[model samples]
Target: MARTTIGDEPRHADYSPCEHAVTPSGQPRDPQSACPGRTTRPVVCNQHGDTTEAHHF
Candidate 1:
């Protein structure tokens, strides 16, 4: 495949927030209230995906 020029790199500037109602961790996309204790939410990204572990079981 032909390589893309340095100046031709794809842009994420146009990327919009995911239409997801909630994060993959089940937390609200836009949190309205705080939980009682510590939160163990997974950090999700389009490039890398969600974290494997937060707190030890």
Candidate 2:
């Protein structure tokens, strides 16, 4: 028999839904910022690769 993948399974149950975040520039926020109730997302500078976390009100 052929192996079945998760995507091949029938959708029967409702999965938990989550809301994605967007940055001030209207881009999708980083995955690391997925923490709940977290207002700030850390940004890493590509040039220096320095990461800094900022907090929102």
Candidate 3:
């Protein structure tokens, strides 16, 4: 898989956020993880990371 920086602008128009900060050793930290309190902001893209919606569950 392609790797991307945490805060850098995406190089591709079809880019998606990696969901979490990479490790110091340079590895994907988690599949569904992100910086703390990041989910509170408005979502610009729903292609990856967290989504903007609610469900009963």
Candidate 4:
């Protein structure tokens, strides 16, 4: 799988802000293992100055 930095623009065209999953390392989680009933909130990185969203499973 490809890895993205904190400020990196979304590589996937299907990027959705309403739902997402992130690991403890602050990386996007694998879709197959993601939780279905989880809700995500937007994430902001001060160092990279980028805005993103993440959820927990």
Candidate 5:
């Protein structure tokens, strides 16, 4: 599947904010594998071994 970044979404990207998107990982999806119909917020994360502005996409 094509993955997208939080701040780099396309012009008409069919994306959604995932609750489990607190880390800079692969495709943003919930534990059940889902997005949209959900909520997200900014959080300080170091999941990738670096301090980055993490949030939902």
Candidate 6:
């Protein structure tokens, strides 16, 4: 992710989505809740190796 400034606000650069999961904001989405994208996709956030609830799957 490249760092860039858009207007007065500083945008935090993000990485591409993880192959095994959905990486939003260059960070993995919490598995305990449905993705904010409003889909039931089985995505996981791997950033920092955080984990989701066991029944998330």
Which candidate number maximizes lDDT?
A: 4
Tens-digit lDDT string for candidate 1 (7-49): 1121122332333355545455556644222233335443434
Q: Could you give candidate 4's per-residue lDDT for residues 1-57 as a string of tens digits?
A: 444344333322333442445665445577675434223343445453436444221
RMSD of 6: 16.0
Off by more than 4 A, model 3: 1-7, 10-14, 31-57
Predicted candidate 6 versus true structure: per-residue lDDT over 1-57, tens digit per residue: 634322221122232222334454433356664333322223334332223344332
In TM-score terms, candidate 2 sits at 0.19
Q: How displaced is residue 5 in candidate 6, in Å?
A: 18
lDDT of 3 at 43: 38
TM-score of each: 0.21, 0.19, 0.21, 0.20, 0.19, 0.15
lDDT of 2 by residue, 1-57 (tens): 543222111111232222455555434467576423324333434333323444222
lDDT of 5 by residue, 1-57 (tens): 454323322111233434345234344445565543323233323332212444443
Candidate 1 local distance difference test against the native? 0.37
List the RMSD of every prediction in angstroms.
14.1, 17.9, 13.7, 13.6, 13.5, 16.0
Give the runs in model 2 whose Cα sits over 4 Å from its true position.
1-18, 31-57
List candidate 4 segments past 4 Å from native: 1-18, 31-57
Look at candidate 4 and give me any clashing residue pairs: none
Which residue pairs collide, candidate 6? 28-45
Q: Which stretches of candidate 5 lie over 4 Å from their true place?
A: 1-12, 15-20, 36-57
lDDT of each: 0.37, 0.36, 0.37, 0.43, 0.35, 0.33
